[model samples]
Target: MDRIRRRRTGAVAGTLTALALAVTGLFAGGTGTAAADTRAVPQHAVTGYWQNFDNGAQVQKLGDVQDDYDIIAVAFADATGTPGQVTFNLDSAGLGGYTVDQFKADIKAKQAAGKSVIISVGGEKGAVAVDDAASASAFADSVYALMREYGFDGVDIDLENGLDSTYMTQALKSLAGKAGSGLVLTMAPQTIDMQSPSNEYFKTALAVKDILTVVNMQYYNSGSMLGCDGKVYSQGTVDFLTGLACIQLENGLAPSQVGIGVPASPQAAGGGYVFPDVVNNALDCLAKGTGCGSFKPSKTYPDIRGAMTWSTNWDAGAGSAWSKAVGPHVHDLP
Candidate 1:
C-alpha cells in the first residue's frame, strides 16, 4: 500500500434529518445498537489499519482479521474534486475481485462478532482538508453517506499534511449529529501532532473530546517529539511512547481516549517500529507504572484504551507476530 507519509491515515438513522441533527447534542437519543459506539471505543483495545490494496501483504476479509483486534480501520476514502468532498475507491482488482456487496457482507460479519470496522482517511499521499463550514458540511455529508452505504460504524481521521481545527470540529460535530449514538470517531495523528495541546490535530481532538472516541497518535515514522515532562524523547523507546501519550492524558483526554500507536514491524513504516515486547513494556509502564524505561508517567493510566498499529497486512506477513505478542499484553493491561 502506498500510503501518504505524514503518517497515515460512520452512520446514522432516519428521523435524523439534517435539521433534527442540528438541534440534538452529540450523545442525544441513541438506541441499544447505538451503544455500539461505547463498546467500539474500548479499553485495553487493539486497533489495526487494514490496507485496502494488496501491498504485498496478506489481504484478509474484514471478518477474517485476528480476533484480538477490537477495531479494524479500513485504509482510506479519497477526497474528491472539492475540499472535503470524498468517495471510496476500493479496487476490486486489488481486493482479489471482492465485490462491494461481498465487502459489505464481511463488514456485517465483523460487526456481528462485536468488532467495529471504520473507514480511515488520509495516508502519506492523502488530500483531504476541511478549511471552512461549507467544506466541513461536505465532509460530514460525504463521510456519513459512506457509513450508511457500507454499514461502517464510524470514520477515522488520518490527514497527514494538515488540518483545520475549527472547521474539522464543525464537520465532526455535524457528523456526530448524523451518526447519533453509534458514531465512532477516532484519530491517527503523527508524533508531532500530539507534542502539544495547541497543535491543529490536538486541538481538534480536544474540541470533540465529548464525542471523540480515541486518539491513537502514530509513534512510528517519527523521529523525536516533546514528552509531557517538557523534554524531547526519541522514537523506538518506551519513553517515547508513554511520555508523548502523557501529553494527551494529562492535558485533557481521559485515559481511555488515548492509545499508543505503533507499526506492526519495521517493514510496516519508514522508521520507528519496535519489537512487540517493547510495545508491551510501554503499555505496562503507562497503564500500571511498571516496566519503566527511563521515563515513567507521573501517574498510571490503568484505563488507557490500548494500542494501535499502522497496517494489519504487515502483521500477517510477520506471521502475526506483532498482534500475537502485543494483543494479549494490551488486553491484560491494568
Candidate 2:
C-alpha cells in the first residue's frame, strides 16, 4: 500500500460559501471584531477524526459522535482550485442525507456540550499547499471563513504533503489575530515530520507553540524512528509511543502540548496499530513513569495532553472499544 493512502478514502467537492461581513461585538480583541467562542479543551483530552465520506467505518452525523471524543475533527476539508484555499462539502447523500444546516446545528450542540469541532485540512492524499505569502493569506482567510460559516472552534493542520514553517507560522498567527485567544490550533504531523525540531512541521509547531493546543503526531504508518534518547524504536509498541513523544516533550513542546495519536483499529492505517491497552500503557508510562516498555523518559510528564485516534468511526464499528477504554483513562490522568 502507498504510504500516503492512510486516511481519507474518497474525494469531496469544495464548496466555498459566501461569508457575510457582518460583525457582532459579542467579545473583545481580534481585528476589532468579536472573537469566536471556542470551547476550552481539557487538561488531558481525546481527539478523534470524524470521516466525511463513507469508507466501511461507521458513518455518523456530528451530533451522534460519542461524548468521549473531546475534540471532533471533521476530516479532509478539500483543497480548492485556488492555491492554499480549502472548502468543506458535507456528503449529505453519502452520509444518509445529512444536510448542511443539520451539520451546523450539530457543531453548535457539540460546543454547548464542551466539545470542540475543528476542520481538519490535509490527509494522506492531501495536496493543500501554503508555500508562499500569498497562498498563506488565502489559506488563513479561507479557514477563518469556514470557522465563521460552520461554527467551528478552530483548525487542525494535518497537511501530509509538505509545509513551509515560515509562512504557516505567519498564517496561523494571522488566523489567531482574527479568531482571538479562543482559537484552538492543533496539528497531526507524521512521525517523520517531527523526528527533529529542525524539520518544517516541528518548526511550525514550535513557532506557534503558545497558540497551539496540541501536536498529536500520527504514531502509525511510521515504521521506526529515533526517540529523544537517540534510540531506534519500531511501531506498534509502547516504546514507539512513549519514546517518540519524548522527542516533542524534551525538545520544545510542553507536557500539556504533546499527545500520542494512534490508529483506532488495525484497518485504520497501513501499520502501527496498537490495542487500547497498549495505548493506555504508553500514556501511563509518559504521565507517571509506569507501564513502560524498554525505553523510558528521563522525567515524567504528568500534564501530558492525552491521546488521539485516526477516527471515531472505526471505534464505533468496533463497538466503541477504543474510546470506551481510552477516554476515561485520558480524563482520569493525574
Candidate 3:
C-alpha cells in the first residue's frame, strides 16, 4: 500500500521466498484436532487485518476481534537478512503486555470458533520478494515453519510494491503442496497491480486459482483505474468498486474467488474511502443486479465472495460501523 515508502526504503529490491499451512480444527477443550477433510466452503467472507502493534486505533487480542469476521490476517512478517527468509517480530511490548503464548492461545480461540487466523506477508512497506526457484523454496519452507510453530491456518500474500508472477507462482505452488487442501491462499494486490488480466498480479492469481481461496484487490489508496469497460473509474465511488471488480469476474476468475477490498474507515487509507452503504450497494449491484450506480456490470456475479477491510482495529475505533453495516448485508446476499 505504501508504494512511495517502498521505493525510498530500498527494502523492496531483494528476491527469494516460501510459505504454506495445515488445518487444525479448534477443539472445545482448548486443544486442536486434525482439520476436517472437507471444511465448509465459505460463501460469504469478512476478512480483516490485525496490526501487531498499537497504532492509535485500539489494539485487540486476536480473539477479541468481532465474531462476524471469518478470516483474520496478521499484519506482517519482516523479510529477514536472507532472501526468502522472514520473521514475526511480536512480543509483550507491542501486545499491551500480553506474552506470545497468550497471543497464540487467543489465535486458537478464534480458530476454535470456526474462524481462521493466517499470517499476512507484506503491507504498506513490506520487503519480501520471490523471484526464483531457490528463493521460492526458501519462502515456502520458512512460511510453513511459521504456520506450524504458530498454528496459523494459512498465509495471505499482500506484497505491495510488485511481484514476479513466474517465481511467485512457483513459491505458491510449493506452499500449496506443503499445506495441502486445508490451506487458505488469499491475496491483496493493489489496484494497479490487478488492473487487467495481463498484469503480473492477475497472472499470478490465475496461475494459482486452483489453490487460491480469494483475491481481494485493494480498492482504496488508488486514484483511478480502468474498468472492464475500458472507462476510467475514480476510487471512493460505487461505480469504482463494481467496474473494477468486473475485470476479475469477467475474466478467468470465478465469482467466488473475487472480493472487493476496502478501508474499514476513512483514516485507514490516504483516499478512496466510501461509506459502508456504498460498499454494500456495490456488492448488490455485482451479485444481484440491484442497488446499482451509473455503471453496472453487464453480467451479475451472484456468487461473488464478500468484502474485505484493511484493519479491524480502525473499524473498532469507528464503533465497528463498517463491519456492523456490511457484514450482515454480505451474509444476506443470495
Count of clashing residue pairs in every prediction: 5, 0, 7
Error of 3 at 10 (Å): 21
TM-score of each: 0.89, 0.89, 0.88
Better of 1 and 2 by lDDT: 2
Considering every candidate listed, which one attains the maximal lDDT?
Answer: 2
What is the Cα root-mean-square deviation between model 1 and the actual structure?
Answer: 9.8
**Residues 1-334, candidate 3, lDDT per residue (tens digit)?**
4322111111121110100010011112211111122133368788888877776676777777877788888888779877877778774686688778988899889888888888999887887988888888889988888899888888899987779999999998898899888888789988777665667998998888887878889887667666666666778999999988887776677787888899888777777889999999999999999988889876788788889997788888899999999989988889
Highest TM-score against the true fold, candidate: 2
Off by over 4 Å in 2: 1-38
What is the lDDT, from 0 to 100, of the residue 148 in candidate 1? 95
Q: Arrange candidates by TM-score, highest first: which order?
A: 2, 1, 3
lDDT of candidates 1 onward, in order: 0.78, 0.83, 0.78
- Winner on TM-score between 2 and 3 is 2
Model 2 agreement with the true structure over 146-250: per-residue lDDT tens digits: 999998989999998789999999899999999988999889998877876778999999888878888899988766666666566778899989988887777
lDDT of 1: 0.78
